[model samples]
Target: MTVRPTDRLDETVGIDTSRPHPARMYDWYLGGKDNYPVDAEMGRQMLALDPRVPVMARVNRAFAHRATRWLTEHGVRQFLDIGTGIPTEPNLHQVAQAVAPDARVVYCDNDPVVPARAAALLRGTPQGATEYLLADVREPDVIIEGARQVLDLTRPVALSLVALLHLVPDEDGAHELVDGLLSQLPTGSYLMMTHATADFTPEESTAAVERLTAAGSTVALRSRTGFARFFAGLDLVEPGVAVVDRWHPELGEPVPGRDDGTIPGYGAVGRKP
Candidate 1:
């Protein structure tokens, strides 16, 4: 059953479609129809900054898929996927449920568009349970609380924050927010994430960030070192913290255009113990 967020929460929600939202822009990149003209205009500007933008998006999604597969295959049955963009096909739940039919997934995102079409994300295998929570990463308590309704926090759960933290600046305490959430999970839990960075192409990255910021979608591109801090104290998996496209390429098929050139993003998976 698709539970409307407005029904889940007592407060009335408002969606402002006049401005470009990151989730909608990402949908535009993935060739989804849930975006408006504002999203396309901003997406085009990003393309002008770097034509590989779409390729990078595909690579990021590939990494998330591979990581989810890896975790499920390794005995992780519960998932808390924050920053889940639009309802793209083969969503996190679908990938995990394919590997382990009983896998349970909780998808979270602040975007109003996501909740509107969240029914697509909730459809999973008969043996598994899938739920969507209309919440933001910044409010860890709200997310964690909502997730407990569908997930077991006492057991090991893979926390997926792929391609999310870049939109959250340091002033917002991105690091603190991650640590705060992980602090509540069991020792065997994991954190899987990918973040955009300025390390590869400084000039283009800076300009892109400026445009995104001006359009109300702030991008705080991190360096390699900054990205590593998110995993502080956790044991990073083998071949730790490599570039998004380069991490465990043998684990999955190569994205068509991902190898053409460098994609400015960092990806890593860490175990709580």
Candidate 2:
């Protein structure tokens, strides 16, 4: 199904291209042309800190693909993907609908660029539905309300938060925001997440965070314990909380250089109740 564009181009105003945006930086890291020079410059700085930055991005994307396939196989037909970055290929709906063509997905992100390029994300199997919501993860009510238009909230919806929470700092009530989103999901709903962390290389992680923060982007690299806190009351899947690349590597092709060293991130899937 082709999801119609709900946002106008004028809504893309207020984009501060002088500074780097996470979504654009991610696009740059993935070798996409959607990012501007500022984003590429900041991405280069991040790579200087950790040369494996691009590899980590691929690993995280692979995890999202594997987790979505697993969820669809396990009977999840609805998905709410928050922090939807610049429309990368094989998006959440593409992965889920591949396994279950009838899957329904709602992609949400605070970045205006996403909505502007959302047409790439909206193409789904005719049996399924895909919609994009221009909202922030902190605004749980807004996300929920928008998601309901496409996904049946009472059904099992896999909330995909891959590579997002780390961008939200503690001062912003990150944990509270996650709890709020989970509270609205049904008992059988799932949370599929991949978060950047400082546990593997504190010095490099710290420097990267400092650079990003200085560039006007929030970087709250968490510890393994802190990442696990987001799934507190949920049931973790097997091989729980593995490094992003290590989580079900059999489910997808390995990201090049993933085995060279730790990826400095954690990924897991958890079911509510």
lDDT of each: 0.88, 0.87
- The regions of model 2 sitting more than 4 angstroms off are 7-12
Q: Which stretches of candidate 1 lie over 4 Å from their true place?
A: 1-6, 9-11
lDDT of 2 by residue, 117-142 (tens): 87654588999988888888888998
Worst 10 residues of 2 by lDDT: 4-13
Q: TM-scores of the models, in the given order? A: 0.96, 0.96
Candidate 1 achieves a global lDDT of 0.88
Give each prediction's root-mean-square deviation over alpha carbons: 1.7, 1.5
